[model samples]
Target: MDEAKRVEEGLAGDGQTQLIKEDCQGDLHKKLDRNDGGDRVEDAPEQPMAETAEEQLQVVKQKSKRVATLDAFRGLTIVVMILVDDAGGAYARIDHSPWNGCTLADFVMPFFLFIVGVAIALALKKIPRIKDAIKKIVIRTLKLLFWGILLQGGYSHAPVDLSYGVDMKHIRWCGILQRIALVYFIVALIETLTAKRRPILLEPGHLSIFTAYRWQWMGGFIAFVIYMVTTYALYVPDWSFVAHDQDVPRRYAVKCGMRGHLGPACNAVSYIDRQVWGINHLYSMPVWQRLKACTLSSPNAGPFREDAPTWCLAPFEPEGLLSTISAILSGTIGIHYGHVLIHFKGHSERLKQWVSMGLCLLIIAIILHFTDAIPINKQLYSFSYVCFTAGAAGIVFSAFYIVIDVWGLRMPFLFLEWIGMNAMLVFVMAAQGIFAAFINGWYYKDPQNNLVYWIQKHIFINVWHSERLGTLLYVIFAEIVFWGVVSGVLHKLGIYWKL
Candidate 1:
């Protein structure tokens, strides 16, 4: 049958798996042949209509059995990424936290990683050959890294400058996509190493989920221990960095002859990044500079305060190497959720496992945060941050699964699904500022007169009369909604950008 007919047939089947039950198809056909009064139709259609319908239904259900919630979850993350990247300037609370607290923007990266784990579990459920898996994983990681470096490696001067070029000496070496590539590579390798030739679900036990993937958990724990030890035990010597004031650069000394410091100035996260990536290669415009110590008006970038600390002006990479090691834990936690989706066939069973795990993580995170043992710092990718964000991600994914997959309420979230399916495309175009930069290149009457500028100024700011609110609205409509529609149209055309 056609696509629409197949979707209908699939929907008419099981709500959770969206697959027709083979054994029940005969019963369904029998019921269909009977009249309303329970008497069989003596003269039914002789075209074998019931048999044809059953065959068509089975075909459709099998084709449509893939999970929809995963796409929706990924789409939700892309939307948030666009929102925070575009409009975070208008709202500080939604922006990246300056030093040691969680914000709306802080959860995006971890959420991405968590879902990556889930995707991994689902995708790698049946790997026929270990060699092929390794090849695919390496190739995918390389592609991700290539795009990450190309998109985020200071190549495009988006929104601000029409010119596009960067000095290789000062280009940033680490970013969101790069970190994702790293996480994916490491985690995928772990999954491959711990994978069984047969499905882990075949192993009989209530604790198969944990027992099956125990090695991956151990790997993650070992990584975490390494991070914790390096973070608290490593000695951070006094260092100096050059801070540019206007066009002039001045060297500033930061004293940190201590260990186990989580402060912005002396954290091991920053120290390792500076040493490995070099200070000049780190992210020039770090979120830490928005702190009160650096900005007289907190949470906004401006002229540095008169008494701002030395580290405030120094460069820092939020997606640095060591912090990424901690980030692996987030991926590991996500793998557990994905395993639940793979191992458990029943909706209630999956929900029970996910919700319990999510709550446990959230509770632990809250305790860590409240006790000040490990604050929820996104820059450091703190343990508490991983727990909190991963837990929230699990809960959120479960919600989407319930609403869209379990209830078959897919229409309302179809846009999200489209975007999620083509997330990398939308992310590169919108969140990475490539689209803005492209449109910005063709400006009228000087570089300031562009479609983006005009829309923000006239359509949003002019109508709203408030810069902050207008900017927020502009992002919600011009960026988020606009991309959602574009993704939907692309979905209609079967165009997806994947690595």
Candidate 2:
């Protein structure tokens, strides 16, 4: 239950800033030597005989070991996720990519999984025995699973509805945190089982890349391939990424074929979910009521399918069994990137390696998208979807690393560190509609004069009288900042929620 950092600790530059010289001895060694008649160096030497630069590097590396950039990247993901989740229905673009293609919203979940992978490498790197690592992994996995269930199955609302309220009759068995925990368990087990390390050459001469965990890497490749083959061959009816008007009857629609093929009755993912958890336990999100999705349906009850409690239930879980495979691949890819971070020593090399890997994944993802091998579909957790999102994540993390770690621009992101410090706590609270309840308490509308609306309309909306713009602004100032302040207070008090 590690609190992944949103910003590096103590990054206002008190200490830990030093130029990484190509060789430590070239300039300083000769200048301090009395026998060689070197330049008169008035500097206080670590030893009368220069014997501790490497030693100093090792200690500094260990003591201030965190990469500021990675923490900021992790922080960015956390904050953006919270923002999107609490957006209060402003822009369509802010939402998840419907079925296929990548979007800003879609990137949040994979980035989270990726960070988990990186965190695993950082936390478990120096452990001496597999048994110790297994013990810790089991504890963390169980904690995540338990919390995920509590957040999803146990947590409830006053009324039952899709999108916002919980339906006790149809409580979603799977969820975001549940998916994360499950993926973590799978990847952690893979890393532990394939724990043996062997060096591989990716540099010139004797220089090698990160100590190659070839087995883990191979496992990632195998898992990805399996996902692809299964997606291609094992589709219930067929592999499809088509969008159809959810309101219309199946026969009347000008269909993409894939859509009608993956209809509520025929979709393989939904079938798996139905068989495993039953439709009653599945999430009956009212997408039509909330996001105005043109190409989705609720067979039980909705504007599209007005026949309440009908037999035509089009249920699909974004975090279903099939998609979990892709989630694992997403996390495994992150573990590989973590290895790159650990394996590469020089800052330049680190950036180079990360960028190159990102570009490669993006290229493959695009190629797959065009070829119809695996379109970027989050519902199915398509291979191309994982690739595109993961590639984008790597590039983003690299940029953060460069700006914050390399260039020392760490001030703006300090606030995000607050959210990153106690991310799970904040996430759970937000998910349980705690923030919404707090907002609702004072956010009432009456015939006389509504207070919350007055402030928003007069202050934010009156600019252009565009309620959308005003609403967005109000959300940023009110919800986002409010949560940030709470997390900051908790961080200051050294209170964090883990297992």
Q: Can you write out model 1's per-residue Cα lDDT over 258-371, one digit (the tens) per residue?
A: 999999989999999989988888887889889888988787877889888878888889899999999999889888887777667678888998988889899999999999
lDDT of 2 by residue, 296-409 (tens): 431112354343322223445777776787688788878777766665556787788788888988999999998876677766777788888889988988888777767778
Residue 318 alpha-carbon offset, candidate 2, angstroms: 0.6
Alpha carbon lDDT of each predicted model: 0.77, 0.59
lDDT of 2: 0.59
Residue 240, candidate 2: Cα error in Å is 19
Candidate number achieving the greatest lDDT relative to the actual structure:
1
Per-model TM against the reference:
0.87, 0.74
TM-score, cand. 2: 0.74
Query: lDDT at 122 for candidate 2?
Result: 47
